[model samples]
Every structure is written in C-alpha cells, then in structure tokens.
Target chain A: MKASLTLGKVTNFLGLGFFITLKDLFTGKLEKEEFKNFLRKTIVPLVSILLFIGLWHLGAKSLYNIEAKFKIEKALQDQGQVAADALKTCMVSGESSCQPNTLPSPSQVWNSFQSLLRDHNIISADKAAFIEKTAAMNEKRVAAGKAAIVYTGRPSFVDQVFTSLQTVFAGFLLALLIAVPLGIFIGLSPNLKSAFNWFIQIFKPVSPVVWYLLVFMIVKTLLIGSTEDSSFTISFISVGLCSMWATLVNTAMGVSTVDKDYINVAKVLKLGTFQKIFKVVLPSSLPLIFTGLKITLSVAWMVLIAIELLAQSPGLGLFVWEEFQNGANDSNAKIIVAMFAIGIIGFLLDRLMLMIQNWVSFDKTDAI
Target chain B: MAYLELNNICKTYGQSDGETEVLSNINLKIEEGEFVAIVGFTGSGKTTLVNLINGLIKPTSGTVLFKGEPVDGTSHERGVIFQNYSLLPWLTVGQNVFMAVKEAFPKKNKKELHEIVANYVEMVSLTPAINKRPNELSGGMRQRVAVARALAMKPEMIIMDEPLGALDALTRGNLQDEILNIWGKDKRTALLITNDVDEGIYMADRIIPLRPGPNATLGPEFKIDLERPRDKTEMNDNPNFKKTRNEIIEYLMDIGNERKSEAKEEYILPDLVPKDFVNQFKFGR
Candidate 1:
C-alpha cells in the first residue's frame, strides 16, 4: 500500500509538472537564457559575499583596525550622530521624525547589517556571538536606565515581514467575511439598499485616519489598552471598514444587474429561494462581484499601510516610521529594503487575488 | 354546448378624453375539436380577441367561458402561442417544450416525459435543433419550437396569435400544413388569429372577420366547407374555395375603402379666413 501511494504521488507530481511546463511553452514564457541570466545574477552576489568573508578569514581576519579607516568611520559617525539626535528629539518631545532627516550611506549600513546578521543567534549562534562582542563595546555610551543597547538584539527582517503579512491576511479575510453576503442582500432588495445607501456613502469616503482614530479610542476603552494592541486593532479595523465598502457596493450592483430574464426563468421553473439565489443569482453576478472584490483588496492594502502609519502598528508602516526616526543609521538602508519588499508583496497579493477571481469566474468561454 | 364562448365581450382602455375601445360586444362560440380562424387587418383587435380567449386580458363588460366556466386568468387548459415566440431564450428547444410537458404532467417519470417531448418535437420537425436556443435558430425554427411546446401540453384548446406571421411565405405555407395535419389527428379545438385570407380559407373550418376598430366587432363568419388535407395548388381549382376567398377579399376591400374615406375626412383641415377680408376682396373684383 505504501509503495502504491508513493508511486501515485510521484505520478501526480510528474503530471502537474508536465502540464505546467507545457503551459509555459505554449504561452512563450519558457526563455531558458533569461532564466539562466536570473540565476547567474542572484547567485553571483551571494557567492561574492562568501568569497569576501573567506578572504577576510585568510588575510587580516583578526587584529584588523576595525575603526582606523577614519574617512569611512567619520562618515559613519556623522550618520550615527544625526540618528541619535533625531531619536532624542522624537522621544523627548513627541515630534515627528520625518522632517529633513539625514540618512546613513550604503557602505556604512551594509557593514552594520553584515555584523548584525553574523551575531544575532536569534538567527544563528556564531552570528549572535559576533553581534554580542560588538554590542559590548558599543553600549559604553548608552545611558543607564534606558533600554539595553545590545547590537545582537535587533529583530530579524524575515520575522518582521512574516508578522506584517499575517496581520494583512487576517484583516483581509475578516473584511471579506463581513462584506460579500451584505453586498448580495443590498443588491437584491432596492428598498433595503436605499435605506443603507446614505449611511455607506457618508462613511465610505471618510479617511482611514478617522477610522483608525475611532477604532483606537473604542479598543482602548473596551479592550486591553497597550499601545501595540491598540494600534493593531485600529489598523485592522481601518482596513476592514474601508475595504468592506467597495466589496459591498460592487456586490449589490452586480446582484441588482443580474439578467431579469434569468430571474423570470427561475420563477417559472418554481426554483426554491435557496436554489434561485445560489444557482441562478450568485453565478450570474460572480463577474461583477469579483471585480468589486479585486478593487476592495487593493484599496484595503493601501488603507492597511496608512492606518498602520497612524496607529504605529508593528508592520511595514511602523518599520518605515521607526527608520525615519533613526534617520542616518543603517535604518535608512533597511527602510529602502522594506519599501521594496512592501511593493513586491503588494503586487504578489494582487496577483493571488486575480488568480482566485479567474478560478471562480463563470464565463462560459472559459469552459474546456 | 360550445367548448369555448366569448359572449358580448367589450374591452376598453382609459377614460373619456383618452378613451380607446379595443373590442366591442364580440360574440363567438367554438365547438369542441373545431378549427376556427379570425381574420382582420393589422390593429383590428384580432390579437386582443385572442388575448381574451387565453385570459391574458379580461373583457370590460362580458365573460369568456372555457367549457362553460368563465376564464379568470391564464390556465394550463388553454395553451397560447404568442406572435413573437416567447420561448425562454436561455433554455434549449427541447427544454422549452419539456418545461410545458412537465407542468402539464407533473407525475410522469423523467424518461416518459422526455419521450413525450421528443415525440412532439419530432412532429414539428425540430428534432435536429432540439438542443439549440431560440437565438441560435432561425425564426421559423423558433416558431416550430413554440408549436412543439403548445402541442406537448396537450391542452383542451390551443390559441395562436399570428404564430406564423413573422415567417417567410414558404415557411408559413409549410407550418400551415403542419398545423392542419396536427389538428386533423387529435381534432383539438383550435383558434388562430391571422391577417391572411388565404391562410384562413386553407386551414380553418370557419373563418371570422374582425372589422377595423376604435371598437372592432366580428363582421361575418364564412363557412369553409372544403375537404380536409388541403393542398394549396388544388385549393385554387376548387370552385367553392375560389368563391369564398373572393367574397372575403371583396368584403375586406369595401371595409378598407370606407376606412380610407373616414380617415381622409377626419384629417381634412377646414380653411379659416376673415369674413371682412373675403367681402373686401369680392368687392374689389
């Protein structure tokens, strides 16, 4: 039985791979040279980094004057000074850190990033030791009673990315659950629709900031009032509310515009209410509903980031804010990386939704 | 007793200034298994008369009786074939016919129902296009589907409101023969409303003419004592057919001429001139 199961699995995998390859070939997406170029570009950088580390291990790995290059050290020191000043001002006065901030240079930030990656056992034990040794030397200047300034203590970029992604998905799913059915109901009955129309119109155009503030206050009052929890709840609520509106409006419109003839046929056939809605009405309105959902998803993404910025939630928006405050340190380089990551992730999310939409779409022409 | 009766039926629309009377005191009786045709010019209340029979519209002052019971509204007992072929466009031809058959015989199993519907579709010669939608087929084929649907219902009376009027002449002739053949078999009571004199003469046992109307009434009934299984080529050679056709044509022509004269006078504008201006012009002359 086990052997047969293994054989079945292998066959299934081969079949899937064959079809995927065939599809790529048919669509003219299988450019071997381009794929090879991508592999070369990606591998070359990592290989170069490994070779650099090896070369350092062989030549002047120990007793190297880590800070003797004052030209580079001076530039790094100036950046760190600016970052410390900005952090002091923001923490002391509750001021924004976005005002005319100085940022660290690429090489300086790259050195710091390498050192942190090497020591954070949070990532690996050898890297954590390196980070701890660097931090022990650096923490002599940090004031007492403040948070510990351990160089090895920084959170992993991957962990931050995963945390943000999880929150976005959770909020998006909640919005979908609330919006789709509500939209269908609104679309079906004109009177019920009209009754709610004014309220939605008024609320839909309001800024995410307003929703964020409202949620913040409510959650603060009713739930555990820690800043992190409050911020997360507010950001989630803002995205949900804003995204929910688009879905609701679109769903209703799609349902309302479903062909009248189909409804008449349903009536003539004496289809039960459930059958009429699920089989006839829902299927016919799917295209419009999906269009609405796609728009809502995009809107929700933007709203989630904006709300996070306002609420100081632990996501990409919060990361951007923290980097802005730590203006001239390696944080600047981290911010740029975060921006790229956010953009790429947003695009992938939209493509994922589009794939789902196409899968569920009832277009007759799509039949095999 | 007549299988269907329209006794002194009058249908009017709107109030005094906007009043439009469609039918006026129309009296008619159709015996069981008899085929009758009502012929009229366009807008002459033929459709209204048919609607009255099918209970699509109620008479203002009179009653329509199907087997001596007043027709309150639409019913399964009276099958109607609309002029525009109102088949559910999404459903296939076989499905459209099957829908009616199912409604008429709800207790029948799926296999039996399918066979019955298929048989009727075969009778209409629409077996090939049974799976096609109305839009997919030609107008003539769509009407054939409509015929199949009505016939499958096996109603006591079938009412057709210009079912073949939209078809080409050749197709019309073909369907007319097909309808007559079907009528001959079951001898179900059938009433057809048409504008074609030859069609009425060819297919109906009796032809009734509805006069032109603000309030149209039945003008006369001509008994078509011709033998069944009518051949159009042979119909012209029959002396009685020729006489009856001519008589009906002449009656229609007379009515048309009278209508033209009345229309002309009603449209003629009276000249408006000042009396003093006319007197001054005469004096100057």
Candidate 2:
C-alpha cells in the first residue's frame, strides 16, 4: 500500500500522472475503462490545437489572396495591363518586397520569432563592445567633474520583456502595500467601509489610459528637476492604481466575512487587538485574501500593457505598439509573439500566487 | 458572595421596530469550585447566556458580577470551550494549546509554556496527533484538542458551551468523562451549557433549565446530590438519578409542547388567484 502511495506521489511530482495512467493501462495495471478516459483527456486537446491552427492558416491564406488581388487591380488601373502583369509575376515569384500585407501565417510568425532572437543577440553584442571601448573614457570622465557617457543603444526584445516584468512587479508590490492595510481597517469598521465604498466604486472601472494620464500629470511634476525618466514610474503607478481595486475589495470581503465562531474563540482567549487580527482574523481570511490577490495580479498584467503604451515606457506594450506602427511585413508577426508572451507571463504569475496560497493555507484540497 | 452572579440579565438585538429580545430576566449564581450546568433544548438562548457570563456580549438591561466586581470584557480567568470546537485550523494541537497557555499565563517562559501545553495534550491523549492540524483530525479529536487548549490555560473558571454537541454519542460520552475527570481534579467554577439531560446529571453538581425562548430565562434548578466519580452504569439504576432525570425531561417536554401549541398560528392565504385563471373563472364559472 505504501509503495503504491509513493509511486503516486512521484508521478504527480513529475507532472506525469496522466501519462503514467496510460503506461499502467499498457502494462495491465489499469482497466480498459480508465484507458478510454486517458485517451479522451490527452488526445482531445491536441486535436483541438491542431484544428485551430489549420483554421488560422486557411483564414490567413484567403486574406492574403484578397490583398494580392486588390494590389493587382490597383496596378492595372494606374499603370496598365503590362505593369499589372509584371506586378503579378513579381508576386508569383514570392518576393518578400511584394508580399501581401495581411494576417501572417504560423510559419511567418515562427520565422519572425527567430529573427527577433537573432536581433536581440546582435544588439546585446554591440552594447557589450561599446561598453568595453568606452570604459577608459567613461572612467576618466567620471574621475573629472563631468558625467560618464552612458550606453544609448536601442533595447533588444528581451530587454523590453525584462523591463516590463520589473514594472509589473513594482506595480504589484505597490498595490499590495496600499490595499491590504487599508482594506483591513475598512473591514474592521463598518463606517469606514461605507465612506470608502464610493471611492473604490468610482475608480475601479476607470480606463488604464486615463489612470496613466493621471499618474503622468502627478509624476511629471514631481520629477520636474530630476534627470531620471518618470515614464516607468508613471506606467507602474497607473498599473497599480488600475489593478488595486480587486484586491482592496476582496481583502475587505475576506476580512468582514471571517467566521463569527473564530471571533468568539479570540474573545475567549482575551487576545489583544493585534493578536486577534494576526492570529485569528488573518488566518481565517487568508484564502479569500489570496483569491483577491490573484485577481489583482491578472488585472495588473492586463492594465500594464495599455498603461505602458500611453506612458511611452520601454516594455512589451511599447514594443508591440512600435511594431504595429512600423508596418513591416514581419511587424504583425512580432505583435502575435508579444501577445503569446503576455499570456504565458500572466499564467505564470497566477501559478506563483497559487503556490504561495497553498503554502500558507492549512486546507489540503488542491487549489484551482 | 457567589463567585459569579447574573442579576436581571436581558439580551436584545436591534432597536425600536426591529427589536429581538432573545433572553429576558435571566438570574443565576454559582459559588467558586462548583460545577453547574444550564440545560436547554436547541435555540433556547443558551449561547447568549454563556456569552453574557463570558463578556463576549453584554446584557442590555442587567449586570454580570464575577468575584464581586462587574464583568467587563473577556479575561484569561474565564476560559471557554465552544460548541463548534473553535480550534484555529492553521495551528497544530500543540501550537493551539501553546497560544492559550501564553495568553493565560503571560509570566511563564517559553519552556514553561511548552511544558504546560505538552502536559495538557497528554492529559487528553492527543500527543500522538499533537503535530496534526485541526483539519487533519477527526471531529472527536479536534474537540479533544480544544479541551486540551482550554485546560492548558488553567483558568479559575472553565465555561463549556455544548463542546461535545457535534460528536457522535460514543465520542460525546468519552469527552464528557474525560472533561469530568479533569474537572474532578481541580473543582474549578465550571459552567456547562448543554441540551443533554444525561450530560448535565453526569457532570454538574447542580443542573438548571434555561426555559425555551423568545424570552428565555432560567427555570428551577435540580441538585445532582450524587457522590463523586459517578458511574454511568450505576446512575441508570440509582433511584435519585432516575428521579432527577425524569423530572428534567418531563419539564422540558411540557415547555416544548407549550411552545408548540403557543406557536401554532391561524393560517390565512392571500385572497388572490393567477391572472389567467381569474379571467377563465370569471368568464366560464
């Protein structure tokens, strides 16, 4: 019995529980009924992903043909049959210059992804070489009463990704700091909750762009004499303001809804105010607080893109916006890549919060 | 003077039109080192009575005096064992006990507190499950942990508000005996609020009935008048035990029947019909 339990634990540890079920079936350790379930679980999602890609490829091809036909007609009207025929020939030859501007195919996106990585590498190398060559001059300048010359090289795609992560984390921390204590105080008092209810309701649904503009107005004035950029600060502050409402509301709800029985126990113990909140109320309300925090994180990530774009911050949002306006053949592909990056990062953040929640919560049921 | 006294206690919620007078004119007194049980049926405001005594909630009208002084807020001197076994789910049994012991005896050092916690945990035979969280333990085991935590405090008075009500009969009997054995050793001023007549007779020196509410108050008290280390098997045939038990059950049934009869109201359905059916009835019938 213990051996099987250990085997089950190891299977889950490696995240191969599903695969092991199939293995068990093949080895006659599982029933035919379970094998059918295994097939349904594994094969259905794979087939669905393939079907989605197939549909996307078909749509892209149709849109490409329409664009090509329109170009050919425009060339015919403006430059005659000979020119249109030449244009058609150029298109038929599959020249990148004459490529139709439309939704890119899966292969085009894959190629664009590779190109971005390669570009990042080249830029990284150039920055390193520039830093090394300028080291002595920068040192001499610093030794003197003058500022050292800094690298003005363009940031790579990976650099922008890192910048975005830093901004979001800053925003997430800021939101947590502001929301939790305020929420606890509000939750502890009914009058305070009533007073703040309008404030939360008014600001919660405001657009991220508007929040960015507000932060920009405040931060730009605050940093008027400072040489450092305020765009990052403004973007992150906006992201925090935009995303903090969910956590604030959730924390309040969690705190207010703590079990009355637990409060009685606190009373019976004659715990001081701090002990009552920390030992009894907080522990009881932690699950709901985590639920709120998860929502806040997702909101932070979602609001960050628009805020970054508005604030002109160096991040994924700006990268996607710049690519969109550049309108190169590969620019659309790059935006798609950014979209995937945003989704994966948001998913990872949610998983991270869940891990922390599970660690703190004594309840042993698997977190959703 | 009595160790604890409730003078003309009344507890009410809301004001004016929304007023709910849950308990009214409740008066009781218990001397120190005496075991007293307040017996009642479900929803007889027994918890409200307990809360009044423990200072969780205050009486709307009267005052509760403990040791010749007016009761204010909760204190370490009066420890409560709640009906729901209000053990903190995050803490293990040992930690739960440690928290109570720390609060009850603030001067004790860490080693002394640990010793107190360990002793109580052992007393309840929960040392095996000492490291297990409240959620991991069975209902009976969790109640035992609560019992350990309350005892670890070593309060002058231990108030139990139907602590074993949720357990199965056998488990309830086991916890009752376990609690009795501990109480026998100390003879603290203990107040038990329970619905069980057998439990009251078995545990308390005196049993008082909390008459059923909308305005519940204490009924007449029954003196157990039995020898210590009261055996359950022997109580079944003890003429005095049988007589007290019968009297309590009969009084409870009488009040229950009276409450039922009093609560039976005349039914008057609204003089209305569905719009569609009304038209049909008016046109055809």
Candidate 3:
C-alpha cells in the first residue's frame, strides 16, 4: 500500500501516470479498456510520426532524381553525349559537387546536425585553449594599461543559439516595460483610451522589416562616435517594437473588465491611487496580462530572426542566412537542421510562459 | 445631528431621453450606534443606495452627510462588505485582511497590524486557512474572509450589501450569528442591504423596505423590538418575530401583485385560423 501511494505521488509530480498505466497493461494488471486507451494515447502518435518521415524520404528521393535527370539532359544539349555520360557517372558515384541542390534527405539532415555539434565542440576547445594561453598576457596588458587581446574566431552553432536567446529575452523585457504601464493608463480612463487608440492601431500592424529599419535609422544617429557595436541594441529594440502590441492590447482589455465589486472594495478601503492599482487592479488583471506576455514573447522570438539577420548580428538568423549563401553541398542540410531547431525552441518558450502564467494566476479552471 | 443622513437623493443612469432612474427621492437618518437593515427585492436599487452612503458613488441631486460632513468619497470610517466576496484572488486570506488593516491604521506598526489581521481571521474560524488563496477556499470561507477583512479595519459604520445572499442556509445562519455577536460587543452604526426579510428582522433594530422600481423609493419602516443577544432557535417561537416577518412579507407581496396587475395587458387573438389545419381537425386525419 505504501509503495502504491509513493507511485501515485510520483505520477502526479512528473505527469508520468501514463507510463505506469502502460506498465500495468504489460504486467497483466490492467483492464482491456485501459490497455486500449494506452494504445490510443501513446502508440498511434508514434506510428503517425514514422509515417510522416517515410513520406518525406520518398519525396526527397523523387525530387533528387528529377534534378539529376534535368542536369544530365542539359549537359547533353549543351555539349555532347560523352559529357552527359561523364556527368551521370559523377552523379552516380555520389561526388559532393555533382549532388543536386534540392530538399535534403532525413539522413543528410541528421548528419548535418551531428557535424554542427562536432564543430561546436571543436570551437569550444579552441576557445578554452586560447583563453588559457592568453591569461598571463591579458593580465600583463591590464597591468600595463593596455587593451586585452580577445579571440576573433567565428561563433559556433551553440554560441549563436545562446546569442539569439539573450537577444530575445532583452527584447521581451523591453516590450513588457513599455506596454504594461501604457496599457494600464489607457485602461484607467476612457479619455486616455480614446486618445491612444489611433496610435496603437496605426503602429500595431507595422512589419518587422520596417520596424528594424526605423530603429536602425534612429540608433545610427544616436550612437554617433561610440566605439561599441550597436547591432545588438538595434536588433532587440526592433524586436520589442514589432512584438509589444499584443501585450498592450490584452493588458488594456483585462484591466477594463475588472469586476465592479472589487473596485468598490478598493474604494471602501480608502486606498490611494497607486495602492489601488498595485493591490487591486494589477492582481485582478494578471491572468490577462500573462496571456498578453505569452503572446509578446512568442512574437518577439518570431521577429527576432529577421531583425538579427537585418542587423547582421551573431545569432541563428544570421547563421541561417550565411548557410544559405554559402551554397555548399551540405548547406541545405544545415539550413533544414536550423529550421527544426527554431520550431522546437519556439514551442519550448511557449510552454515556459504557460507554466509561469499558471503559477501567478489564481484562476484554476484550466490547469495548463 | 445624526451619525449618517441621506437627503432627497436621486440616482439615474444614462443621459436625457435614454435615462433610467434607479433610485428617487431617497431620504434617511440613522443615529449614532444604530443598526438598520434595508430589505428589497433584487434590482430594486438597494445597492445604489448603499453605494451612495459609503461614498463609492454620488447621488445625482442630493446630499449624503456622514457625521454632519458631506460624503465626498470613500473613507476607512465606512467599511463596506460587498455582495460578491471581493477577496483579491492572488492574495492569501491573511494578506487580504492584513492589507486592509494596514490601510486603515497606517500609523500602526507591522506587529500591531498583523495582530489585528490574525484576530479577525481567527474570529471567522479561518486561522487554519490564513495562508490559502480565495480560490482554494469554499464560497462560505471566501465570504468569511471578506468579513474578516472589513471588520479588521475597525470602521465606525459597517455597510453590508447582501453579503450572505449567495451562501447556503447553514453558512448564512452561522455568519448572521457571528455578525450579531460582534455587533453586540459594541453598538457600532451598521447598515445591511438584503433581499431576505427574516435576515433583516433578526439582525437590525429597525427594518425598512425598498419598494420595487422603475424609480424605486423607500417604503414604510418596521420597528423591531426584540431583546438583545437574540437566539436563532428561539427566534422560530417568538411572537414578535412572526408578526414582523408576516407584515414585511405581506407588504412585499402587495407591492409585487400591484405591479403585476398594472402591467396586465389584454391581447386580442387574430380572428383567422389556417384553413388546412381546420379541415384536418374536422376530418380527424
């Protein structure tokens, strides 16, 4: 009985109740109905994923063959039958340059992912060695009042990912700082709401490219002779401007809809204006504010790539653009790898926001 | 001068031609340390009157004077317990009560404030769940916390608007007794707005009915002569309780029936029936 109790606790803690159900079914301790549910939840999805990959592989193969045939035919028409035959032989032998530039196979994308990992490992080792070798030198320079020499090597894939995360977080903070207070002020009075409505409507739908350009134009003049690189500032600011509308709108909506009874309570307490906002207004509207924040974070992340690419910042967006331009045999595979990484990271960020929203919001009607 | 007075108060919603007059010609005076309950049916502008007294809202054309001073806005002296338990969902019961006490007694140190919060929370028998959020508690428990919060402020006048209407019978009975017990200790000025006639008769020195509305106004007041420390079980057998209850209920019934009869309209049915339906009925098809 104690063991079963502990198992139940563990199931609740880790959301692993299904695994126990599966174990029970396999051990003949489950009912037929329970076993069927296990299959429906767990097994069907696995089969569907395999089916998806199989279709992708077939499609990739057909596209490769079509391109290869087209290349050979063009060679024959341009030169001679001998040249066509030589090109076919090169393609059949799987020479790197002769490979058709098209949608990469699943295995090729997997290999590219592994290669990127290996490159990150190598670059990390290089960085560690360089730091060690220059530790004494850097110290000497500091003592002599001279600048320290730093590593000038290109950032690895993992470094780029971290840079992107840092930029997105900065952007998300910026958006929250600008939107929430403005939204509250607008929500408090009808006059303010009407006055600001036109501004928000006009700017909310502006594209990321235009926002980036606007930031760039202003930041360039503002940072005049400063030696610091301003791409990070520009990229994050543009991201913030592009993504803040959802948070602003949702916060205003939430604040305006607070229950009248709660307002009355605040009034009867004789709370000051700021106290009313902090104690009564903010707490009541937090669920909607969090929903807005979730949307803002996702939008920040989506616009971050384009802004980074435009600013030429060292992040995933720049990395993807560079890979596309490099035109190497494995570049397509590497780009596909980055695409998957971006999708998975976006999903993870959303879940993180959801977890935070649940923690702060007193509404428990929905668990997740 | 009375402790609280409302003079020729009128309240309306909307503008000009589209106006809805919720309350009209409302005037009342309550002496210091008097307990009064205003009973009305739902949507009879009982809340508007309460809001006017507490200074959460202003009357369109009349005066609300508290302690002979014009009521301009809300004050800690008039603590209101709203119908819906407006406990901030994010804050625990201890924190909700603590915030009010802190606001009411800003000069009091943190220790004194905490003591007050703890005392009231214990008064409502919610000491075990002081750290619980409103969502975690039952409806009755939430209302109890709201009570604890309002009373902890040490308001001179406690204004309650149908606070126990949403609760079931057992919780309501328990809360009514608890409120009475607290009021018995010090006869603070209190006003309760409710739809329940019995609740008014049991709790107050005087019971006043708010007539039903298009422009609802105050009806005649019923004076309750029940003795102090009123017993709930004994209340069922008391002659005065039955008489007052019957009188209030009958007056309300008369108001309802009068309104219905006035609204009763005659409708003449169209003098034609469908030819096919008539033929089918005659042939019994």
Per-prediction DockQ scores? 0.06, 0.72, 0.75
Between candidates 1 and 3, which one is better according to TM-score? 3
Task: Calculate each model's fnat, 2 decimals.
Answer: 0.00, 0.91, 0.94
Better DockQ candidate (1, 3): 3
TM per candidate: 0.58, 0.92, 0.92
Query: Which digits, one per residue and each the tens of the lDDT, describe model 3 over residues A1-368?
Result: 79977886555434445777767777888787888888886788779989988999999999999999999999999998999999999999989888999999999999999999999999999999999999999999999999999998989999999999999999999999999999999888899999999999999999999999999999999999999999999999999989999999989988998988788878888889999898899988888899899999999999998999999988999999999999999999999998888888898888778767766788855534
Kindly report the docking quality category of candidate 2: medium
Lowest lDDT 10-residue stretch of candidate 3 chain A: A8-17
Candidate 2: tens digits of C-alpha lDDT, residues B83-106: 889889889889899999999888
- Per-residue accuracy of model 2 over A1-368 as CA lDDT, tens digit each: 79877777555544446766766777888677887878786677679989998998999999999999999999999999999999999989988888889999888888888999999999999999999999999999999979988888899999999999999999999999999888898899999999999999998899988888888888889899999988889989988888888889988988998999888888888889999999998888888778888889999999888988888899999999999999987899999989888998898888778778777887647355
User: Which residue pairs come into collision in candidate 1?
Assistant: A118-A127, A119-A127, A119-A128, A119-A131, A120-A127
The segments of candidate 2 whose C-alpha lies over 4 angstroms from its true place after superposition are: A1-37, A132-149, A364-366, B264-285
Candidate 1, residue A213: CA error in Å? 7.1
Task: Order candidates by lDDT, high to low.
Answer: 3, 2, 1
Model 1 residue runs over 4 Å out of place are A1-368, B12-19, B44-48, B212-214, B264-285
Candidate 3's displacement at residue A224, Å, is: 2.6
Pairing residues by index, what is the TM-score of model 3? Answer: 0.92
Give lDDT: candidate 3, residue B127. 100
lDDT of 3 at A7: 83
Assess each prediction's global lDDT (C-alpha) against the native: 0.76, 0.89, 0.90
